[model samples]
Target: MIVYEVFRQERKGQAFAHAGSVGAPDAAFAEAYAREQYGRRGESVALWVVPREAVAEIHEFVDELQKNYHRVDGYPLKEKLKEARERAGTAPPADR
Candidate 1:
């Protein structure tokens, strides 16, 4: 089996994110291949090469139910704001 790891630099000072993976024969091949695949048209600033065996893959997520509490959009703010405005009696125009 052949495997290749790719690390991409999103922007200055930003750590590279493991965008995805591909299969290749060796390190040199992976580097030559990845530079083109990831940086083609200069989309990325940098990349790292690693063998398939050297990389660990995480494929499983432990979420067994809804986990909205960890999300910002989880809490409905518009309705709460409207209720607060009504209670405070300081609501402004719809356009404002």
Candidate 2:
């Protein structure tokens, strides 16, 4: 038996998400099984039954180098905003 991935669109104009998987002998069987499992209630607008072998899996997601600039803490927006306000002669009045 071949494993298949099932993707379903809940409604028109919406993105499709992974619904589940089905094990079958071929594409025809996979499609029928996916339809029966996910679309029997008429809730799915569309379905895509793709073989597991056709899908690519990513196993490694490690970032070898540390890049602090990619995070929010690396952005010093307050200082930049203060400089811009100063340059525009719109600095907030000195606190009383």
Output the number of the TM-score-best candidate: 2
Q: Each model's TM-score?
A: 0.53, 0.76
Model 1 alpha-carbon drift over 4 Å, by segment: 57-96
lDDT for model 1, please: 0.80
Backbone steric clashes in candidate 2, count:
0
Q: Give candidate 2's TM-score.
A: 0.76
Residues 52-83, candidate 2, lDDT per residue (tens digit)? 99999999977667676888877889999999
lDDT of each: 0.80, 0.93
